[model samples]
Target: MRDRIFRRGILPIAVVAALSAVAGCSASGDTDSPKGSAAPSGSRAGRVDPRSAAALRAVEQATVRAGSARIESSTAMGGMLSLKTDGALGWSGDQVGTLRITYTGGQLAATMRALSGASMEARLLPDAYYAKVGDTFARRLNGRHWIRYGYGDLATLPGGSGAYLTDQLRTTAPLQPVRLLRACGDVRRVGEETVRGRRTTHYSGTVTPAALTGEDAAGLRKQLEQAGVATETVDIWVDDRGLLVKKAEQGELVGGRMSATAYYRDYGVQVSAARPPAADTADFKELMSTRGS
Candidate 1:
């Protein structure tokens, strides 16, 4: 198995330099935000008021609109990475990766993946992804051959993607708390700052049951951690237009640290309600069994 970190479209040196600014430590819980909130089993969404409800609804709409645009995002990761179990893995220090997404009028058409950890590049076509490590290559078959691939899940093909992130940003009804206050429950302003040159609206609140148990949130965590992972803090950042500009999570898992960050750009496209192909049901069952074993 060949697994390594990758980078694209930017200087590896510069990317590393940029990532160096981020501390090599985990962010502690901030009670002011929902990320620090804990979830209990068998819970339902709490009652939210009208004004806060409108704010959340507007935020959700803006997020969907932003996701409708093409985007390019870069991330720098550092950790004791174990690519495979039983010690085939070694440690990877501060490494950087860049992902590029091509969308035509808000529909994802292509994805380019590059990682510096192992020097790999992969291109994803609609239903399949071609991965190349130097002159060697492998093919990952995506079951969905009809619907196009989303950028969120594109660059991280077979693992996670920009498309997956976009889907999460597109929420409706009770699932969309940022859109309606009654759906959002309690809210607190977490102050504001500029991101990528855009003035943004920043608010942090406790995670409601609807927030925690929702399919999108659960799917996001489950899909990212198919191999069993632990992470801390799920943050949602909205821009001035009330759109979610970024979503980030940071945490430690398996003896190594792991993280996933996504940015929403270019909004206003109609998306299909398609889902990422499920990992093999048998494999999933076996994974659960082994975890218990």
Candidate 2:
């Protein structure tokens, strides 16, 4: 039933109504860059080279500098469609949700939870977050509360159970935005492709740090590694305007291995007035500021 609806491709519709939130350009951490050669003496106008690495580096660096953003993401995998699991693995293609992330000064503060057909809202916050899951108001002060109180980290893991285990491996590591981009290493240009009838650039890459610190994260990574799961391959399609319009991943999820893809379109980045951060809430000023933390 869910697959049937997704097959119709409602992502474009979701984008129109401000329900879609996943869009990002890759960037690397600011490191020491090599100085370019000095211009020839007595030449007011220097010859411009378009294909130089310096030019490409300048563009890449510009994309990164215009960072610190919030965007929506919709992902669908296999678990929910297969009926083997409730889609806890994050591989369910029908699994749809919104992610609100703010990267301020290179630090990441994020909260992402999925809303499925079951009318359930499972949220993961960077600091403290409260959820009203069908009238059940629950709140967590830190990451530990996410274990039983919220949906397992979705960004770290691969598939459903496998991704959940992957979350366990990186749970202790600060979920940095730059780190996420770095994990998605070497996004080589695969020429242009059409997504939803729109021309977009295609790039593929892999994730890094198969294992991380912390008990829950470490144990999960160990379990999956011992299980001999293969690494994940990511495919991305970006429009001529530099917006990510589509993304796909192929990986394993416990006994069932599958491939999942998400197509993005009419990409616009904005914060929903209906779902503002906790700081913007009426009672937030009286509670605590999400700014300092």
Best by lDDT: 1
Which ten residues in a row are the worst by lDDT in model 1?
82-91
lDDT of 2 by residue, 1-293 (tens): 22222233221112111111122111111111112211122231222233322323333443343332233333322232211111111111112223332221110011111212222332323331222221112222221221121223222222333333223322311112212223333334456667668886554443323533323344434433543444444455555555445544444544344443333433222212123344422222221223134
- Please, what's the RMSD in Å of model 2? 16.4
Worst 10 residues of 2 by lDDT: 82-91
lDDT of 1 by residue, 1-293 (tens): 22221222122212211121121112112222343332221232453345545666676555433434322332222332111100000012111122222112111111212222233332222333222222222222122111122323333433333333333222211123342222224454445667678776664333422343332555433433432333343345667677666544344434354443445554543222222234411121222223323
How close is every model to the real structure, measured as TM-score? 0.42, 0.39
Taking all chains together, the TM-score of candidate 2 against the true structure is 0.39
| Model 2 whole-model lDDT (C-alpha atoms) | 0.30
What are the runs in model 2 whose C-alpha is more than 4 Å off? 1-77, 80-117, 122-126, 129-131, 135-188, 206-229, 264-268, 272-293
Clashes of 2: 17
